[model samples]
Target chain A: MTSLTQQLVDALGIMVLGMGLVFLFLGILILGVELVARCLSRANEASTPSMSEQPMPALDSRLVAAISSAVHQYRASA
Target chain B: MDGLMAFWAETGIAHFTPGQMLMMAVGGLLLYLAIVRGFEPLLLLPIGFGAVLANIPHAGFTEEGGMLYYAYHVGIETGVFPLLIFMGVGALTDFGALIANPKTLLLGAAAQFGIFATLIGAIALNLVPGFEFSMKDAAAIAIIGGADGPTAIFLASKLAPELLGAIAVAAYSYMALVPIIQPPIMRLLTTQAEREIKMEQLREVSKKEKVIFPLMVLGLTILFLPAATPLVGMFCLGNLMRESGVVDRLSKTAQNELINIVTIFLGLAVGSKLSAAQFLRQETLGILLLGAVAFGIGTATGVLMAKLMCKLSGGKVNPLIGAAGVSAVPMAARVVNKVGLEANQHNYLLMHAMGPNVAGVLGSAVAAGILLAVLG
Candidate 1:
C-alpha cells in the first residue's frame, strides 16, 4: 500500500482502539463506583436504626409543661 | 562616515524584513486581544510579548544560544512544559460532577470524534494545491479540535514540532472562543424542548471516591496506554494531591505558582515558533481553517450525542450540556449553562454540564495517547 494509505488505515485503527478503550475504562469505572456506593450504603443501613425499630421514648409531660410554663411566665414578665 | 554607516547597519532598521514587520504587527494584535479584549490574558500576554521579542531583527532571540531558543529547547521541544501545565490543570479540576454521573464519560468520548474527523480532513487537505501536511502534521493540526491546549501542545511537540506555533494558537484561540463557537452549533443540533430539559442533581460523591479516582485512572492508563503516562501521570498526581487533602500546599503550588511559572515560559516558547518564515505559510492557513472545522464538528457531535441520550433516557438529559464535551473546562460548561438558560430561564445546567466538561479532559487525553501510540 502507499504510505499515505497505510497511515490512513493506521489512523482508523487508532480511532477504533482508542474509542473502545476509553469506553471500556470508563465503563469499568462506573461499575466500580456503583459497587462501592452500594456497599457503603449497605454498611450505613446496617449501622443505622431501621424505621421499623421502636422510636425513642417520649419526653416526660410534667417536665415539658414546667419548661413551657417557665418560658411563658418569663415572656409575660418581659 | 564609514564607521557611522557600519554602526547603523548593525541596527534593527537595517536588518528588518517585511515578514518580520508583519510578525511584529501580529504580535501587537495578540497583545491587544489579551489586554483590551480580555481573551485568555494569562497566556496571550506572554505569548504576545514573546512574539514581539522573537521578531526583532538581528536580536538573536530565536537563534541558537538566545534566551527564547533555550526556553524552547529545554521546555517545549523536550515536552516538559505541556506536561507541567497538565498537572496544574488537574490540580485545578474537580471531577465531582463526572464522578457523580460516570455516564457523562460517554459524552467526553463522543466529542473526540471531532479530533479523528479533523484528522481525516487535514490529510484530505493535501489534495488542495499549495497545501502539504504530512500524516504527522495532520495529526498535530487535528488535535486542535480536542480544545485542550496542553494536549495540543504536547502532541505537537512530540509529533510535529514545526507546526507547534500554529497548533497552539489555534487550540488556545478556539478554547477562548468556545462561548461563541459552541452555542450556535448546540442550538442547531438540539430542539428547544430538548434544550430546556432539566437534569437531576448529581449525587454527592464521597471523599473516598474522589481519592480513589485518580489512582484508578492512573492504573488504567498504565495498563492500556503506557505512552500516555507522562501526561496522564502528572495530571493524576495533581488530582490525587488535590483530593488527598494531605498535600494542600503542593496542590496549591501546582495550580497557582507552578502553572503560572510554566505558562510564562511555555507561552514565550510557543511564540518563538511564530517567527516570520514559520507563521507566514499556506500550511498555517490550513491549520487555522481545519482547527475551526474540528472544533465545530466536535461541538456538533457532542450535542448530537446528548440528543441521542436524551431520547434513550426519555428526556432526562439536556442536550445543551453536551456542548461541554469539547473539553474547554468550565468555559464550555458555562456556555452550555447560558444557552440552556436562554431556552428555559429556570433551568440551571452549569453543574450538569460540568460532568461532561471534565469528562472531555480525560477523553481528549486518551485520544492523544491513541494518536501517539499509533503514529509516533
Candidate 2:
C-alpha cells in the first residue's frame, strides 16, 4: 500500500516536472533559433543586396530586339 | 538404440515446447507484417527473424556466450545502438523548416504531453489485480508514447530490460499505424476551416544558420539537460557533419551505411528479448494497450496545441499539422498534408508540417531524458 502511494506521488511529480522542463527547453530553443537566424540574416544583408530589393537590370536594346524577333518568327511558323 | 534415442531427444522437434512454438508463430506474424504488409520492414524483418531464432528449443541463442546474448549486451545494455541511430537520424533530417518557424517548437513540446499522460495511466493500471508495475517500469512503458522507436528502446533497456521487447514492438507498431490511428483523432479535434488554414511560406534559411543550428542545439542541451546529451549530442554530431559540408564522406556513411548496420543489430537485440516467458504475459497486453493510448493522446495534444496556436496567431496556422508533433517523421507530416488536402485541395501543408514533425524527434528525446533523470 505504501509502495503504491509512493508510486502515485512519483508519477505526479514526473508528469509535472517532465512537461514543465520539456516546454522550458523547447521554449529556449525557439528563442535561440530565432536569434541565430536574425544574426545570420543581418550578416548576409550587410555583405550583399537582397534579390528582391535590387532593381531589375535594364536589357540592352539589341538583345531585346533579337529576343522579340525570335519569338515573332516562332509564332509565325507555328 | 540408446544412442539413437539421445540424438532424437536433442532434435528441435522433439524438444519444442508449446510456449516456444507460440513465440515462433508470433515471430512469423511479425515477418508477415514486414514482408507482405510492408510495415517497417527495415527493423521488423530482422526483429522477427531474431525472435524465431531465439525460440528454437535447445538452440541457446539467447543463452550466455550466444550471438543474441552478445548483441544484447553490447548494443542495448550499453545503450550504444540507439544513440548511433540518432546520429544517423540527425544527418538525414533537415532543420530548415523548424528554424524558419520557431513557434512550432511549442507544438513539438506540447506533443510530448502524451508521454507524461501515459505515465500516469501506467501507474493507474496497478489498481487491477495481476499487474505489478513499478515506477521505473511505468516510466519505461510510458515512453512508448514518444513515438520514437530508438528512444523507447533505450529507456526501456535502462529502466526495465525485461519490458524492452514489448515496449519496442509497441512503439514501432504504433508508429507504423500512425496513418490509421491519427486521422480520426485529428478530425475530431479540428474543424474544416482550421484544417485548411494555409500558412505563410517559410523563408529561405542561410547556409551559416544551417551549420550553426546543430551546434546551438547541442550547446543548449548540454547546458540545460546533460542527461539528454548522449542522444542529442550524437544527433548534433551527425547534423554538424552533414551541414559543415567538409565531411561529406563521414556524413554519407553515417546516414547510409553506419545507420543501416546499427539498425540491423538493434532490431535483433530488441527481438532477442521477445522470448516466450518475457513476452507472453498479461503485462505485455497492458503495455500494448497503454502504447496505443499514448499515441492517441500525443496526437490529440499536438492537434489541440496547433489549434491554440492557430487561434493565437490569427488563424495563420493549420491545426492539422500539430498532429505531426508525434514525431513519426515523414509519415506524420504526410498524414497532415493528406488531411489538409481533404479539407482543401490547394492546401499543401507538407513543408509546413515538417517543422513540427522534426521538432517531435527532439521533443521525445528531451522527454526520455526527463524520465531517465527522475526515474533512473
Candidate 3:
C-alpha cells in the first residue's frame, strides 16, 4: 500500500542507518582485535623470561658441578 | 473407452503447461551448469533436481503433504539451515589471516554499500509496469549483493519468501561467476602499480588470540545488534570449537558431515520454491539484473576502499585485495590473487586477501542483521 515515493525514502533511510552502523560496528571490531593481539603479545613477553628462568633451579647443583668438571677435563685433555 | 480416456487425462504429459515445461528446462540448464560447467555443483545439482521434481503435474511434490513442502517449512522457512551452514563455514574458515591484519575490515564494511545501493535500485524498478516490489521484497532482493549464499537465502526466506528462488539463483550464479566478474572490475579500478603493490608479511597469530577473536566478535554483536546474533552466534560457536582445539571431533563433524547433510536438504528446499508460479515473473528478471548490479557495485567499492587505504598506507596495500571483500569466500580471494599475479607473478595476495574476504562474510551478516532489524 505504500507509495513509490515512500518506499524510496525508506530505502534511503535504511541505506544511511545501515552503512553507519556497519562501519561503526566493524571499526570497533578492528579496535577489539588490535587490543587483543597487543595484550596477548605483551602477556607472552612477560611470561616467557620467567618460564626460561624456571628451568635453571630444576637442575641440581651436583649435576651442574659434574657438567662443569667434565667440560674442564675435556678442555685440559684437548 | 471411458476408463482409457480417464487414464489419459491423469497422465503427466496431458496435464503439462508451457510454464511447467519452461521451468523444467530452466532446471535442466541449472543441472547442466552444475554438472558440466561445475558451478556450485553441491547446491545447484540438488536444486536443479528439486526444481524438476516440483514441476511434475499431479506429483504433489511441492503440495501440502509433500517431502519438499516439509523440507521448505522445516529447514528454510524456519531459517535454521542457513544458520547451520554458517556454523559450518565458521568451522572451515581460518581467522588467523584476518586477525593478523584487522584494517582490512574496512574494505569489508565498504563492500556492503552494494547491498544498500541495490536496495534503492530494486525500489526504483517499480517504475517499470510489471515491477511492483515492496519494501520487504526490495530488502530481500538487495541482499543478493552480499555474495554469501546462506545469507542471501536466509534474508530471502525471512523477508521475501516468494522471491527466494530468484534471489538464491542470482546470488549463487553471481558467486560462481566471481572469477570472471571480479577481475575486470578489480583491474578497472586500480592502476597496474597499485595492483602490483606487495604487502608486508602478516605476523603469526598466537593460539590464544585466535581463541578470543570469535568470543569478542560475538560479544560485540550481542551488545550492538542482537538481530544478527543468530547468524553471527552460530559462526562464533563453530569458530570457538575449531580454535579451542579441545573439540576436534565436534569441529570436524560441523565442518564436514553436518554441513554436507544440511547442504543437501537446503538445496532441495530452496529448489522447491522455483515452481513456475513463483519464478516466472518480471520481478524475477529485475532481481537478476539488480543482483548483478549489486555484485559489480560491491566489488568496485571494495577496490576503491583498498585504493584509499593504499594511499593512506603509502602503497603497502594492494587494491586488488579489496575486490575479495565481496565475500564469495576463497573464490573471491583466489580471484584477487590471480589478478595480482597477472601484474606481478611473484606476488601472492591470497593470505592478505583473506583478511578482507572473511571480513566480507561478517560484513554481509551485519548488513543482513541491519536489514532484518529495520524491516522485519
Candidate 4:
C-alpha cells in the first residue's frame, strides 16, 4: 500500500496539473466569449439597416431569470 | 505587617511580570487601533479582546481547559471557521464580472508569483537567529502575500499554528494596508496615461452565466484539488446561493449574519494565540518584516504582468488594476478606481478591477491549497 507521504506527493502533482488546467480553461473561455461576441456583432450588422440609429435594449437578465424560475415551478406543478 | 507586605508584593505590584503586562497592553493598543483608527475592525476587535484575555497573567483562558482554548479547539484547530468564511465570501461575490472578462484571471495568476517567491525568501530568513522555520512554516508565512486573511489563517492553522499569531496579524495588517501599499507600486509601474486608460464598458453578464459559473468553478475545484475543496467549495456554495434566485433568505443570512458572527469568533481565537511567549518574540518580528516584503513583491509582480498584458494587448489594460490582484477584494479594486479617477476623471476601472480582485481570492485559495498539499 502507498504510504501517506506518497499519497500526498501524488496529490501535490495533481494540484499543479489542475492549476495548469484552470489557466487553460480560463484562456479558452475568454477566446470563446470573444468569438461569440464577434459572431453576434456580425449577425447584427447583416440584419440591421442603419449603421447607427438606436441600439436595442440589452437582454434583460432579471426578467428572464424570474420567468424561467416561474416556468420551472409551473412545470413541476403540472 | 510582614505577611501583608509579602502578599501585596506577590499579588498586586509584581503580579503581571513585564512580558505579561506588555502583551496585555499590546492587546489594548490593538483595540484602539481597531476602534478608533479603523484598522480592520472586524478582525482587530476580536483579536484585541482575545489578546487581552490571553495575557492576563496566569489566566488559564487559552490553557487546555480555557474558554478561548476550547473555542480555538472547536473552530480553529479543526480548520472550520476559515472554510465557513470562504463559503460566505463565495455567496456574497458576483462572479459575472469574472465570467464577462475572463482575461483578468491572468492578472490574478500573476499575483500568486509573490507567494511562491516569498516562500523562498522565508526559507532564506530561517538562517537568521531566533527564526527556526521549516518548509511548512515558510509556506504558511508566505501566504500573507496573497493578501487573503482566510487563506493565510487556513494554511497557518494547519501547517504551523505556532506561527498563527504572527501570520494572522500579518495577513490582516497587510490587508488593511492595501490602500497604502498598493498605490505607490501601482504608480511606479504604470505611466500616467496607462493609469488613466479607460476600459471599454463590460457587456451585460447574463444571469444564466452567473448561475452556472459557480457550479463550473466548484466542479473544477473538486477535480483538481480536493484539499482546497473546503475553501473553494464553500465559496462556490455561497455564490450559488446568491445567484440561484431560490434561497435569498439563506444567502442573506450567510453573507451578513453568519459572516459577522464567524468573524468575531475567528478574530478572538486568532488573537488568543498571540500570547507574550508566542507573539512578542524575535521570530514574530521577522515574520512581520517578511510579510511586508512578500506583499510588496506580490504587488510588483502583478503590476509587471499587467504591464506585459498591456504591451501584448496594445495598451488595453490599465496596469493600475494589476495592484488589485491581491485578494483584499473591493478595497484593492476601489484604490485602483480612485487612482484611475485621479489620473483621468472619465476613467472607470472599478468593475474591470473587481474581476481580477475577486479572481485573486480564488487564485490565493488555490495557491494555499498547493502549499497545504506540499507541506501538510
lDDT of 1 by residue, B313-348 (tens): 989999887889989998999999899889889999
Compute each candidate's TM-score over C-alphas: 0.91, 0.93, 0.93, 0.84
Select the stronger candidate by lDDT from 2 and 3: 3
Candidate 4, residues B136-229, lDDT tens digits: the string is: 7878888899999988998998999999988998899888888898888888888887887878787887676777677776776677667777
Share of native C-alpha contacts between chains A and B (below 8 angstroms) recovered by candidate 3:
0.93
Query: Of the pair 1 and 2, which is ahead by DockQ?
Result: 2
Q: Of the pair 1 and 4, which is ahead by TM-score?
A: 1
Q: How far is candidate 1 from the true structure (C-alpha RMSD, Å)?
A: 6.3
Best by lDDT: 3
Candidate 1 per-residue C-alpha lDDT over A7-63 given as tens digits, one digit per residue, 9 for 90 to 100 = 677667666776687667666767766677677778778967764688889999999
Q: Which has the greatest DockQ?
A: 3
**lDDT tens string, model 2, B19-130?**
8999999999999999999998998999999999999988888999999999999999999999899999999999999999989989899999899999999999998899
Candidate 1 lDDT for residue B285: 89
Q: How far does residue B26 in candidate 3 sit from its true spot (Å)? A: 0.5
Mind listing the fnat for each candidate? 0.33, 0.87, 0.93, 0.07
Residue B367 in model 1: shift from native, Å?
0.4
Poorest stretch of ten by lDDT in candidate 1 chain B: B123-132
Q: Candidate 1 DockQ category?
A: acceptable
Off by over 4 Å in 1: A1-10, A47-78
